[model samples]
Each structure stands twice: as structure tokens, then as C-alpha cells.
Target: MVHLIKTQSSSAKSRMGPASLNPDLPAVAGLGSFEKLNGFFNAIYDGPTEDPPWHSALNLLCETLHAKHVTLILKPPSPVSTGILVNTDAVAHDATEAYQNHFFTLDPFVGLPEGQVVTPEELVGDKVWKQSTLYREYLKPLDVKFLIGADIQTADGIECRFRVSRGGDIPFSADDIALCRLLLPHMRRALQLHSRLDGLETERQLFAGAVNSMQLGTISLAHNGAVIDLNPEARRILAEKDGIQISNNVLCTDNRREGHELQRLIKEALSGSAGKKGPGLVEALALTRPSGRSSLGILVKEIPPSPWTVNRQRAAAVIFIRDPEASVAETSQKIVQQLFGLTRIEAAMALSLANGSTIEETAENLGLKKNTARTYLRFIFNKTGVTRQTMLVRKLLGSVASLG
Candidate 1:
């Protein structure tokens, strides 16, 4: 017959103090109990923004509960998935590795009723638990004598497991369970916030990567025309100090006439009066480079103010700059070649022409005769279904080659 540890029911346990179960547990440090709780709650709320989210809160919980290990299974392990696991510093690397690799399936303490805290002995009879493979081979060797755990289910369908382990005879007290129960709701909310923030950050990185891959210079400006943010390509272009540069934290051109025009366009975009055509109008200009390279193409467009940000000096305008002299990425060239099934020479010629180079210039660059370049260009036109050089440039620019 299985022997079970007769513990008090949930109602009776809620009334007991921490000293009732474990009198040797350490006392709080200099701060009062209220202050410590306040700090823990703060850490919990601050977790989503932290680099390694919840590290501080988990460590504090381990200390507060006097637990040998505090493990948070953000995602539970399954037959097909290894899942996500986080542990406090008290957990050794080998113990964690072993549990994740082989013993997770055998753990009988998991899948506890959502938000209901229970010790292993309470969940499974003491005699049955001691005889189990997980107990004898995993917990016993690690000196884990007692454990308290609960499963947290978020509204977004995330199942999280919170576990606290103790090595000695002292089991978790009723006060410890009460504290965990109180914090469970907050933990659920924090995890939901973290999931949403993580998704947004991932999407931002994806779009930023696509823009950077295209070598497109993007500059975000505040309502007052101050430079708020810029992608890597914009930073590179400004760093060269060629035609466009940032002066007084605002975008400006080196040429006096072009500089005034650029400033006017930015002002128009910010003031919702592009040439008095009203808001949402786009303006374009070309800045002549001092280096005698091809002029830099610029487009300015107004950013509509959101309902909640009507009064804020947020990003009011965006400037898109493109350098005609910039060559397409080598990977993009390969993609273009594959997409059109063009010969290597033909593909190189197409990319050169797309970059605003003339057929004669491309011929000279590729060591091919002007007639041969024209022949290759004709072949490209036929294969790509474009009749004109301008059409071919539009086709290549609109293709997925830029995403390469």
C-alpha cells in the first residue's frame, strides 16, 4: 500500500505561519517584510523589459522561500520538443542537463491543477514517489527531499510550470504556498506582456533587416525636423559626407540650392503642406554630390499622427535616400540571374544597367564589346518580358532579388 504524507487541507494551510513548517528558514534582511514584497513585485513587473527576463525575480523568490532550486519551465518538455527551461543559480548545470535530457518525462510532480500549489508527497503517495525512477535516480542523487510546484495557464495558451525544491527535511510552509498563490496572477500577466513585446521586437528586426539588405537609406525625423533614427545604410551615407549630411541634427544637402530645397520639403512634410497640396503628399529631389558621382535621390513623406500621439513631437516625416552609384549585393545578383535564367555575363550586365549605368559603361566594365552588351541586354529584355531599358530597371528593382 502507498503511504502518503498527511498534510493539512488548503483551508488549514492558508492559516499556518512560515515557522510552522520550517522554523530554521532565514529571516528577512534589513528591509521590512512589506518592502521586500514590494521589491519582488517591482522585479516581476520589470521582467518583460529585462535582457534575460525574470532573472532578478527568480533569484529573489529563491531567497525568500529558502529554496535550494527555483525552476521555471516557460514551456514544458514534450516527446517532440525540448522546451524552454530557466533555473536559479542554486541549480547545478549537470542536474539541469540530466532533468531536461532524460528525467522530464518521468517527473510525477508536473501537470498539477492550474494555480494550485502542491508538494510531491501530497500529489503522489510518499511510498510510491520514493520508489519511482525519477525519485531514486534523479531527486535522491541531487539531495532534493521535498518540492512544491504549480502550473500556470495564461490566456494566450501558454502553460508554465513553477517549481521550488528543498534538500533537507523542512517542507514548504503554508505561508510559502500563500505567497506563491498571490504572485501567480502577476506572473501570468507579466508572461503575456513579455510574449507580446517579444513578437513586436522580432517583427521590427525583420523589417529592419529587409531595409538594410536593400541598401536603402531610411531616416526618421521628429516633428521639428530633428533626426530621430536612421538605418545602417543611412548612417553609412551620412558618414561619407557626400551630397547629404546631418547638420544640427537635421538632414541637409551639401549644395546650397539643394540644401534649401531639402529643408523646405522636410518642413512641408512636417507641417502637412507639401507644395500646399495638403497632407500625405510625397516630394522628391536630387542632391548633386561634390565627388562627381551620380546624384542622390531623395523622397520625403509625412507620417500621419496617431490618435494617442496627436500632441507628441514624435516621428513626423521619413526620408528615403538612394545612391544610384551603389551596386546591387552580389547575392542579389545571383538571385536575379536564377530568377531570369540569365548567363553570368548577362546577369552582371543587367545589374550594372539597373544601377543607372549605360550599356557602353557596362560593356567597358565587363570587358565586352558595346554590341555584345546590347545583344545581352536584348536577350535579357526578351527573357524578362520587358521592351525598354527603363522597364527592365523597374522589373529588377521590384523583384525579390532585393530581399536576398
Candidate 2:
């Protein structure tokens, strides 16, 4: 299934890498700079997006060394390409995204000869660098000159190799390669931190998704008693202070006593106890939205972790809201079928309406013709004696919405 067809490209002709690990290179890098770079990497690695701000670090390295520009080229996940990880102090800023998105897609720099030590004389001398397509599209406009690099074994994956580049007209000296060897530790640690931060962000999003998928009123409160997150059910109970702020541990008059109990339960769970996870004497919280109303019970549990991944010792608590009252589905059926005596299909249409779906959406989902859906709406109106969707929803919700 794998093929290695040779291409008559300039990079193919040059095929450069280190000749050998330099003897004078420091065995270990400085620890203080490594920690600082690690911290920066962690901050961005936890971002919601895949691309981290590694270019900034490369810029710092460039500034410190008085280099014109520095680029960190990461070998692609596949052997077919080279991806630019960081292009700091770039010359062709306009083409930066293009290089990252497309140029690197074909750059022959990735599949360069591995294992043996290489030098510029091996990869590109005078003629080959001028003819390479990647240099023309990415490096030419940027005025890139001298290029020195090292291929590192990536910690996570095989196809991934690390290379740092200093761009200029002058050729790199042996001392320059030694300098890079000195800085390799910082680069490796930075990448590892980025990997960990990415894991944390993914965990957060997964937790959020789990919270939303539950048929419960859930709220995540920060350590300082301020609410940081809320699902639909919990939002209503918190009364969403300022139309956005909501908390599980809210100090509202309606659920003050209950919120206090929930907070105590969280405290217990954080203090190495499971808290009252059983069906205890806690009362369900009332939810009143404009569409439907229901009651929600609460449960708290710890986020799962392996032995080494114990970052959340006293971090956020996972709140589970269980609707004791009828769910949104049940509420919609109760309102549309019981009150209006509509057929199950017609009741489903009305139920979908209650969930904020437009008529077209409801009809498409049920595989019913739009006109037929309209007819059912008419019948619902005639039976319930309500002229509009808003009125129907209001009648069911009764100032309290179901968390369904």
C-alpha cells in the first residue's frame, strides 16, 4: 500500500542533514529558560483550536540570538509533506497561511535523507535552493538566506521531526549548529507542555458536551462562589444574573437552602469523599422556561483520571441534574397529546416546536411534507384553541421550563 516514487526535485538533489552530533554542544540546556517556555506552551496548548502560538517562542529565540528570522518546521504527520510549525519574523507574511495550508503540502523537505549527519552542502548549495518550489513560494519573498536545521525524534509520533531554521544570506557556521544543539531541550519541553495543555482543553470540551447532553440542570461554580458554567436547566434556576451569569451554588432566594446543600456536597466530594451520591433527601429544583417547566435533581461526581494525570485534586465538580418532573419530551407530549388529543405524529410536530425548531426543521426531521406539517399545526390550533406557537409553549411551560 505504500509507495516511494522518486521525484527529480531540487531538494531531492541536495538531501542535507547534520554530518554528526557536534562534540562541543552542551549535554543539557538551561533549566530556567526551559521552564518559562514550557509555561507559555501550556497556556496555548489548552486553547480550543489545534494551532498553538509556538511562533512567538521562535521569535524570542531569534531576538535573543540576533537572527533576522527563525522558523520551526515540523515534519508532517505523513511522509509526503513538511509543515511549517512556526515562521517568526517572517518576510512573506501574506503568504504565511498559504505556506502552512498548501505550500508545505508539497514541500520535499520532509522526506530528506534521515539517520546520517548532514550539512548545507548536502541539502542545498547555490543552485538547488534557488530551484526548490518551497523556497520560491515560502522563503524567497521572505528574503530567507542561510538555513540551518536539525531533525529531532518527536516524542509523540514517528513521522513528526523537529527543525529550527535561521534565515539569512550567510551560511551557518559549526558554532551555529552547536548553539542549536544547546537549545534543543527547551524546544522538546515546550512541545510536551503543548501536548498536555491540548489534552486538558479537550477534556474541558468533553465535560461541557456531557453536561449539555444530560437531561438535568447542571451548573459549574468557580472556587470563589461565582458561577462559571450552566446548562439549560441550571440557567433558569440561577435566574441568570445579568442575563448570563448562572451558578450551581447560587445564593438565590428561591433555592438558597438547596444550593447550600449542593455546595456542601461538592465540598465533601472535593475532600476525598463521594458525598451523598445516593437518592438522598434533597428536593428537586424547579425549572421555568417559556417553553416547558420541569424539576431537576442534582448529583456530583469526580472527573476520572489516571494515576499520573491527577491535576484536578480540588478542581471543578461535575454536576448532574436529573429531572424528577417530566422531561421536555414528556412535557411536550403531555401538553400536545393530552391537552389537544393530536395524533402521535402531530404531537411530535408540536413537541419539536417547543424545542425551538422551526416548522421546516420539524417537518424535515419527521419526514413529513411541509404542507402536511402546516395542516397538523392548524389542527393543533383548533383543538388547543391557541392561535400561535408562542401561546402553546407558554401554556405548557407556565413560567417554568423543563430541562429536557
Candidate 3:
């Protein structure tokens, strides 16, 4: 059994009161119940940045309601297998797996009419529940005598189940059921938040992977000029200490004049005034390297506020840096030479043109005559099946050739 365990809160056990009198009628929960619940809510809200330590919260729920054991299961219908989110250690792993594989079909709670919170006693009479195979054979072996569960979600044919079970013959009181009902909304919201955060994290990882693969340095900034996050490439540039580095969590360059200019651009972008000229305007600057190598190309672009922009604390502007002296260009050259079967000179010319250079500029850069450069460009156009220079550059850039 794959158990995702989280330890219980310290106060959870102490705050939970014993089983009350009049097990059939409702009773008011204690004053300390609200404080105990606040801890669970904190875990739920923290779920996006980190996995919430929900075991403590679930343990609190079981203890608060006087249930011996509890389990929460989130599963998609049919093709997708079920997963146990939380399970109290009181139940053996083997017993849980056995119930999951075989006894699940016999569960009276499986097809209970869709409702808020329902107990076995409410769904089926105590006599009828006792007579069922689920109790006589499966649950009897596990020693679970009573159960209370809620259907949290049943969207798109996927069902999420939250259930608490008690041992021995002592039945749950009305207060236990009411407590479960009270806790249902919090549990439901936490699950939804978990799902949303999972999606956002996956997208962030995918984007980060793509950016890293291309050797593009990306730095996300807060409104106050603090560094929110930096990709691997950005870190590499900062470590080089040739041109750019992060000081005081702010982007800095070796040259004081250049640094001042960069800071001004960053501030402008953060202020949401960088695009005042038009929409989606990207401010560009170049940082001179100490080694006198190719200057690093940097672009600071303002990002409009979105639903994901939490109070504009972070992600106000994004700085994209490109290091021309890096091995990325060499890798791209190799890829172009291999894929297009071009000579080294021809490959260099093709990449240069794709990077928005004119034929004259390509010739000058490669130390070749205008006619020789034109011949190479013509050959590239023929091989790539494009007549226009613009189309040829587009083809080369769009292909896997430029991904190096």
C-alpha cells in the first residue's frame, strides 16, 4: 500500500473530547474546536507552494468526531486507478488493499443517493447493514463497526470520497455526524486547491524546462525589484560575473553606467509604464562583458496583471537575457551543419541570416566576398525549398536546427 503519511498535530489528540451521551441526538462541539480547525485551514492554504501536511488535519478530523480510523480516497472512474490520500495507521495496509480490490463493490456507501453527509445508519438501517456481506465478511474482519462519509466531488465521472470509520460496537453520536458535515466544506476546498496547484506547477516545470533547454536566461521580478525566481541559465550568467550578477536580489552589471541604465528599465517595466508607447513593448539593453567578448543581449518586458498575479507582489516584469558568447550558438551551428549537410561556412551564414542579418552583414561577419555569401545563401534556399530570404530564415529558425 502506498501511504502518503503526514504526522498529526500535537493539539489534535488533546482537543478531541470523548464520545458524548445520547449517541442518537446532536451535541454542541467544544469551544476549542475552532482553534483546532484553524490549523487545518492553514495547511490547506499552503498547499500551492508545498504539499499540505494534511495527515494532521485528517487525524484531527477523526479525533474531533470520535472516529477510530479515517481514510480519504480520490479516484477517477474506470481507466484510472484509485489512490489513498490519507489513512489512519490503526487499519492494516493489507486490510485496506483487500477492501479496495474486492470489498469495494459490496460497500453500501458506494451508491448512496448523492447528498451532503450521510452515515451507514442513515442510508441503511442498523439491521440491514449488519446483514450485508460488506459488514459480516469484510468489515467484520477489520473491526470497523460504523462509518460516516461525504461525497466531496463527482465531476466528469470522477468521484472523491471522504470517510471516517469507528471500531467496536459503539456507534457515532449525532454530533460526530454534524462535525463531519462541518468539516466537509474545508476538505472539499482543499482538494480543489490541491488540483489547481498541481496544474500550475506542472505548467511552470514545462516552461522552465523549455527555457533551460534553449539556454535562455529568465528572471522574474517583484514590483519592489526583488528576485522572484531565476532559471538555470540566468544563474549561470550571474555566476560568470563577466557582465551581469544579482546583488541585493536585484539584477546588476559590472559597469556602473550600464547597471544604472538596466535598473531604470527594470523599474520602468515594473511600474507598468514600459508599454506606454504601445502594447507589449519590450525594452532592450546590452551589457558589456569584462572579457571584451560579445555583449549579452537583455530584454525587459512588462507583464500585464492576470488572475495568477497575486496582488502584483511578484511577476511584475520578466528579464530575458541572451549570451552570444555562450555555447548555445556553437550547438546551433553544429545542428545546422548536421541537419542541412552544409559546410561550416554555409552553416554559419545560414544561422546569421536566421538571426536577422542581411546578406552583406553575413558576408562581412564571415570574412567572405559578397558573391560567395550570395552563392551560399542561394544554395541554402534551394536545399530548404524556399525562394525568399525571409521564408528561408523562417524555415531555418522554426526547424529543430535552431533549437541547439
The model with the greatest lDDT is 1
Off by over 4 Å in 3: 1-53, 76-84, 88-109, 119-143, 154-158, 306-312, 325-383, 387-394, 399-404
Greater TM-score among 1 and 3 belongs to 1
Query: lDDT score, residue 226, model 3?
Result: 88
**TM-score, one value per model:** 0.76, 0.56, 0.66
**Residue 378 accuracy (lDDT) in model 2:** 91
Assess candidate 3 and give its lDDT. 0.72
- Evaluate all candidate structures by whole-model CA lDDT and list the values in order: 0.81, 0.54, 0.72
> Pairing residues by index, what is the TM-score of model 3?
0.66
Put down candidate 1 lDDT per residue, 1-404, tens digits, no spaces: 11223455566434444423442222232223445667878989998897668888888898888888898888888778777888888889888878888899998887688878787777888888889899899988889888888899888888999998888888777667767766788898999998899899999899988887788889999988899999988898899999888889977678999999988888888897764694455569999999999999999888877777866667898899888777764446678889999888888888888887899999999999988889998999999999999999889888888788
Candidate 2 on 182-237: residue-level lDDT in tens? 45555565556655666898997776654454445565644444445666656654
Residue 291, candidate 1: C-alpha displacement in angstroms: 1.8
Model 2 clashes, total count: 21
Give the candidates in order of lDDT, highest first. Answer: 1, 3, 2
lDDT of 2: 0.54
- Which candidate would rank higher by TM-score, 1 or 2? 1
Of candidates 3 and 2, the better by TM-score: 3
